[model samples]
Target: KTRQKGKKKKKNINLNQSKKQSVSFVCLTCHEKEEIPLSVVRDFDLMDDGDPTTPPMFSCEKCGGRMYPEYYEGVHGIKYRLSDIL
Candidate 1:
C-alpha cells in the first residue's frame, strides 16, 4: 500500500484584526484628529433622526468637540466644513 500524504496546515487569521475598518475624523472645534471605526459611524447613522441636512459626527476624545469625517458629503450634495459653517 502507498503511504498517504498528511493534510497541510492552514494559517490562523484573526478576523477582528484583519477586518477592522476605520476612518479619520477631524474635530471642527479643536482641529483634533482621530481614527474611528466604520462600524461606529454606521451605528451613529442608524440612530440618526433622518436628518439629511446634517452630516455624521462624533465627539472628540481629546477635546469633547464635534468631529466630522475628513471628507464627507451631505445628501444634498453639499460639502460641509468648519469654515463654511462658521
Candidate 2:
C-alpha cells in the first residue's frame, strides 16, 4: 500500500470573538452618529431595570446634547431601532 497525504479538518471559529457587538448612537442636536461596543452599553447601564427597550440617554461629546440609540446592531445578526426596541 502507498502512503497518501490527507487534508486536515477545519475548525469552527467563534464569530463573537471575531467581531465585537456594538450599537449605533445618534446625537439629536448634531445628528452625529457613532458605533460603540456593546460593553459600553453595559457600562452605561442601559440594560438595567430589565428593560431592553429603554436605554439610558447619553450626552453628545460634540454638541453637548442628548444622544440616543437610533439603531443598534449586534454581531449575532440582531438589529433594531430605538422605536423598535421600545
Top candidate by lDDT = 1
Q: What are the RMSD figures for all models against the true structure?
A: 7.1, 7.3
lDDT score of residue 65 within candidate 2: 88
lDDT of 2 by residue, 33-84 (tens): 8777778776666345555545656788898987788765433334546666
* Lowest lDDT block of 10, candidate 2: 3-12
Which ranges of candidate 1 are over 4 A from the true structure? 1-20, 72-86
TM-score of each model, paired residue for residue: 0.57, 0.52
lDDT of 1 by residue, 57-86 (tens): 889998899887775544456565555566
Q: Name the TM-score of candidate 1.
A: 0.57
Candidate with top TM-score is 1
Residue 31 of model 2: what lDDT? 82
